[model samples]
Target: MSEVVLTGVVKRYGPVTALDGVDLTVPAGALTAVLGPSGCGKTTLLRCLAGFERLDAGAIRVDGREVAGPGRHMPAHRRRIAVVPQEGALFPHLTVAANISYGLDRADRRGDRVDEVLALVGLAGYGDRMPHQLSGGQQQRVAVARALAPRPSLVLLDEPFSALDAGLRAGLRHDVREALRADGATAVLVTHDQGEALSVADRVVVLRSGRVVQSAAPGTLYREPADQWVAGFVGDAVLLPAVASAGAARTPLGTLPIAGPTTDGPVTVLVRPEQLRLAPASGTDAVTATVLRHDFHGHDALVALRLADDTRVTARVWDSTDPVEVGAEVAVRVDGTVRAWPATPVPAPAAAADPRPVHPVA
Candidate 1:
């Protein structure tokens, strides 16, 4: 296993800068995921770590050994880092066993290493099958097996499951995670899919505009985002302008407790869909809203609503059987403490129309 460290990393192409003074530490024997939108430098970061691209500035070290720095550049082959590309780029003519044994030395090729890696990826008895004969998911498993056969110090997976179906992708993710854990391999995954990053990786690094925005464990990142932009990007958020005093914020949903300390002033409160509770319109203390739409999933449903003041919000209902019809009057109440930030300046048109504004779903 290897711990990779990067400090002040920067890369540029002509007038455009891809990476900008980024510092990150990937722990040993853990899966770290780099997540961001397109053109956010995720691929550039991975290439720098794999020794494929020269760093314009800063240093990269693996296991306390400088691999890329001033007056020194180690080639990709000598870095002991393996990469699994998007498509399963396996040789069509080579059998499963032969593809895995291609990277091993002549002496190691003749040993049982290929069989060991095949078994590790849950394809023990199908070594003689050709690439065309295997399913897409099976082909990806072979790709992973080949990357692991050489016992690399670090493995980089570039959206390996992006091409598969949803069911297949989920299953393959679990299998690959298990295989990496069993081998005690340190891996880095680069993907734009938020769900994949949140579910599979031990640590998630969020990048935006060539800079690191946030890096934390999945649960912490989701529950406590650094700012309103991050809160909206990670999950469904309802942002409301309100006045905060003491420890509560007064909003369209009535008074909601704040998660942490805040000065007495205008604030923007973040309420997750799951935190809002709905019931039949009843008591005077509850805020009433008309259901605009109901989207039902197997496990839960997202109910869109418009308040008496024409502010829209969404609530997640866990009870799938109790259907919420459109145009139904429902009483809304907050279930828990919410995150709050200092209020941002509203746009001129939006501020002129309403003194208190509610942002749409993000």
Candidate 2:
């Protein structure tokens, strides 16, 4: 196990900067996920850590040893860092056991290390099978096993589950997490998938525009985002204009308790869909809204609503017995405290016509 640290890491491609002063610490024997949209520097950061790309400026330390830094650059093969890439990239001609033993030392390859890692990834007794004989999920398991066979100090998984089907992806994530934990392997996973990052990693680092926006545990990140953009990006958000005072805020849905302390003034309230409760519209104290749509999931349903004031919101309903129908009036209430941020004024429209001439479509 190794604790990886990156300080002021920067990578540039001519005038374009892919990574901008990124400072991160990956704890020993824990999985840390780097999450972001495309072009957000996730891949660039991973490449830097793996020694595939040299840093323009900054330092990388693994287990307190400088691997890439000023006046030093260790090649990828010498870093003892293993990467499990997307598509499982296994050799079709090699059997499951052979592929996993590929990276091991000559003597270790002839030992039980292959079977040990296979069992860790839940692929025991299938060593003789070729890569094509296994399912997609099984192939990914082989990839993970191959990475673990050599007992690397650190592991890097680059969107390892992106190529799998939805059902397979979810199951593979759980299995992979368990495999890494069982082996006590420290890993860094780079993925654009929000759910995968939140569920699989011990900590998630969110990146945007070549910089880290936030880094927190999954629960903390979901329950308390840094700002409105992160709130909307991580999960479903119901943002509303509100007036805050004391410990509560008044929104179109009525007064609701704030998550934490905030200044008294106009604010933008963040109400998660799961925080909204719906009931039959009858009580005068309850705010009423018309159901615009109901999306049914197996275990839960999302009910979209439009308040009398035309404010649209969504509520998550766990009970599927009494389904909410479209166009039906329902009473809406907030179940718990909500997050609030200072209100950002909407930009005013131009008072005069544009100086540039508008071309009429022929």
Model 2 error, position 200 (Å)? 1.5
**TM-score of model 1 (CA atoms):** 0.93
- The C-alpha stretches of model 2 lying farther than 4 A from their native spots are 345-362
Instruction: In angstroms, give how far residue 173 of model 2 lies from its true place.
Output: 0.8
lDDT tens readout by residue for model 2, 1-362: 89999999988877678888999999999999998777788888888888888888999999999999988999888988888888788889989988888888889987899999999999999999999999999999999999888888898998999989999999999999999999999999989899999999999998877888899999999999887778877878998999999989999989989987788999999999998998899968789999999999979999999999999999999997678889999999888799998898532221221112111000
- Tell me the lDDT of candidate 1: 0.86
TM-score of 2: 0.93
Q: Model 1 segments beyond 4 Å from truth?
A: 345-362
The top-ranked prediction according to lDDT is 2
The residue pairs in collision within model 1 are: none
lDDT of each: 0.86, 0.87
Task: State the RMSD for candidate 2.
Answer: 8.2
Check candidate 2 and list the clashing pairs: none
Clash counts per candidate, in order, are: 0, 0
The clash tally of candidate 2 reads: 0
